[model samples]
Target: MKHGFKQRLFIVAGILLVVCAAVWLVISAISDNMRYFVSPSEIQAGIAPEGHTLRVGGLVVAGSVRRIAKGLTVRFEVTDNASTIPVVYTGILPDLFREGQGVVATGKLRADGIFVAGEVLAKHDENYMPREVQEALNKAEGAVDVGNAMRKSAGGSL
Candidate 1:
């Protein structure tokens, strides 16, 4: 009876250990694979990871958007008033995607610094701005006097 009880206890402990290990692995995986979105200036300032997948958003640079092969593939540049990143997308772009419109793309950066976008998302209107970009712009425009240098550009207020 003592031997049987000891064996059952050992089996339970082993199962518990396995479960704990599995949970830990799952949590680690989720944390590692989670990606975030950033703007062009953020990328230029070295705020984003070099090799991880991320979303980049900005206005489609004026006169820089071109359609290739009946709207199947499009090439454009997203500019955040400071820097621009070239983007290539092989899927149907959102209807709001156009010259000087806001856009967001998700993908990894290529060796040549171009963004190879897997998905292209666009905003509905000219006034559309990401929350982070809006705040950055407001602060940069001296809407708040925080000692940060004000930056103004032709592509938009921010």
Candidate 2:
């Protein structure tokens, strides 16, 4: 009876070890696939990791969209009013993509400071903007307000 109990315990331990390893592998795979959202200002300040997939949200800079080939390859600039990042995408852009519209691009930042986008998403409705883009804009506006206040206190132009 003692030998039988020891064998059963060893079997259970082996099963538990396999289960734990499987769970760990699944969690690591999911985390590796996850992408983070960032603003153009954050990217410019070196807050976003290079070579890691990330999403960037901002308004499409006016007069910046240009097609480089007969295919769907295009390039443009996304800006948060304070900072701008150039993006290149090879896929067909959304129907709503246009100048001055809000956009989100998911991809990796290259060494040359340009975002190589895997997907480009544009605002679908005229009055709607991505939540990330809205938050970034608000932050930029607040910063501008603070700067103006500081200038006024220093006896500078409003």
Model 2 gets an lDDT of 0.82
> Top model by TM-score, which number?
2
Name the top lDDT candidate. Answer: 2
> Candidate 1 clash total?
0
| Model 1 per-residue lDDT tens digits across residues 35-91 | 787777767667777788888876677778777878678888887656778899998
Off by over 4 Å in 2: 141-158
Cα-based lDDT for every prediction: 0.71, 0.82
In model 1, where is the ten-residue run with the lowest total lDDT?
145-154
Mark the regions of model 1 whose C-alpha exceeds 4 Å error after superposition: 69-71, 125-127, 136-158
